[model samples]
Target: MNREAIDILVHSAWKLLEAKDYLGARELYTQGLKLDPFDATLWNYRSNAHMKLQHPELAFTDAARGLQLLDDKLATTNLSPEDRNFSVFMKIDLLFRCLLAAENLDICQTALKYIDRLLTNSHLLSNEARQTILSKQKSLKLKIKTKRHAFARASDSLRLNLNDVLNLGTMRITKYPWNEFEPFNSENDIETELKEINIMLEPIAPKLLVVRM
Candidate 1:
């Protein structure tokens, strides 16, 4: 491995990352990877750059690769205590990045897997970060449950709306779309007439309300 050159690239990329120049950092990391693709640190940081750029799939892939590399190192090679601790730290961070990317991809199950794996190392985390992961696990469980329930009822003609989703976690049936109307085209303002009628009814409808007396 061309360690010296890779170190320079990694250092330069870190500076770019700190400056929020994600693309520049990505480019530098890519160059370093070309020299030494096995550098788990480079892959992890590049995964972070991919995430910052909103490329979830790329971020997840790179993070997975980084974790695999780190795992291999920890399994096969004996290292100093300091080195082992740092590698474990990197492994946990890669899992975190993978979890975030999976969530962005709407693969909640994958996110849960990564979160579960992370919690096993909870002792290494600060209280705040550990709490955040626990909260995320709770959310992922609810999300998975909601998704499964919704999917079971989904059909070719049935469309999902915000209320349909919001209703899943609660027992009470929600009044979705208090008024159901035929779908109206919005580009030409097809609902303008109905909107006007509704506005006109605003005054009369209240008058129709019965009093307890």
Candidate 2:
């Protein structure tokens, strides 16, 4: 297609995006790519449209392609001011979304690694954008840390002391209201059990109350 036709397609697609008609935007972007298959800007817009549609895997694919095309263009000569800015923000945002869409820990970590690399390139991203990306990184890191810590704690708890745990081999876990007031059990027996538990927990309860205060 000629330059004018390509421009028209790109402009129309952009307007569709502005209206939040992601499916429409993607349709136009796909048509535009047919005319100028190597247009990184078109790919970037398409990627964003897919992202807004909650098609993260497709979004990541298009974003990666756009980045590759941008890198090739940069290798030959510098990007125009508008293109440069878009490239910078697109890289950061795409990585952020990709990280969020990742289902597994390994994929999340991989996406985060790329995000950190982008954050380090001070020349590409403005200070405000860098800070925004950094905040996202911090949140993802904390989530990962919490998940790992919980897993580790669970693993640790599994190594119980059989001596302290009565009838460790015969024990069966029960849901709360452990066993309904059994008709076979006397009120006195239930009261005695409750009293013993309260006595055992009495010292800890006072410490907990003080901490809460």
Candidate 3:
């Protein structure tokens, strides 16, 4: 296909994507890719469509390929500051989504590095975008920390007493509400009651394992 035809297909893909017709977008992207396999923009759009379709692994693969192609193109050409900043942000955003879906902490950390670079170099990003990046970075850091803490706690529990660990796990698996509490009238009240119970019982619940140990 000619460049003009490729452009038309790309534009059609964008229109379909804007309309939230991801499958239609993907079809257009596939046609574009057939004509221009190394078109980074088409690949990126295809990745977005795949993500919307809940195909995270395929999305990540296409995003990575697009970024690689873009990087090569950038190395040879001098892009304007605004264009460079936008491209970097898009790459980082794609990586962040892919990492989150994969639960890959290392990839998330690498994406944060790009976010920091964008924040340092670009003044064009809106305050909301900056805040959102900061929020995502903070959330990923907390998730990694929480996983590490849970692993450490489990290890310590097992080392301290095997029977206690087993009983604790069993209790967690078996415990169920017996309907002693009234039906929650509102979401807020339900959340408040659950939070209170969690806070109050968390420390005392471990003691139950002592008897089993």
Best model per TM-score: 1
TM-score of 1: 0.71
TM-scores for every candidate against the unseen true structure: 0.71, 0.59, 0.59
| Model 2 lDDT tens row, 1-213 | 366887898899889888988899898887877777667677677777877898765665566666666666656655688877666666655555545444222354555666677767756767886787678677778876775667566667698553344333221211111111212122566555654564466566621111100
Lowest-sum lDDT 10-residue window in model 2: 171-180
Residue 2 in candidate 1 has what lDDT?
Answer: 87
Where model 3 places Cα greater than 4 Å from the true spot, the runs are 77-114, 120-122, 157-213
Question: What lDDT does the true structure give each of the candidates?
Answer: 0.75, 0.60, 0.61
Candidate 3: worst-modelled 10 consecutive residues by lDDT = 171-180
Please provide, for model 3 over 64-175, each residue's C-alpha lDDT reduced to its tens digit, 9 standing for 90 to 100.
6666666666676588988776676666555445444343324444455546655674465678877876787787688656755776687884566543433333212111
Which residue runs of candidate 2 sit more than 4 Å off their true CA positions?
77-107, 153-213
Candidates 2 and 3, the one with greater lDDT: 3
Better of 1 and 2 by lDDT: 1
Q: Residue 145 error for model 3, in Å?
A: 0.7
Alpha-carbon deviation at 95 in model 3, angstroms: 5.4
Candidate 1 regions exceeding 4 Å error are 155-213
Of the candidates shown, which would achieve the greatest lDDT relative to the real structure?
1
* Of 1 and 3, the candidate ranking higher by lDDT: 1
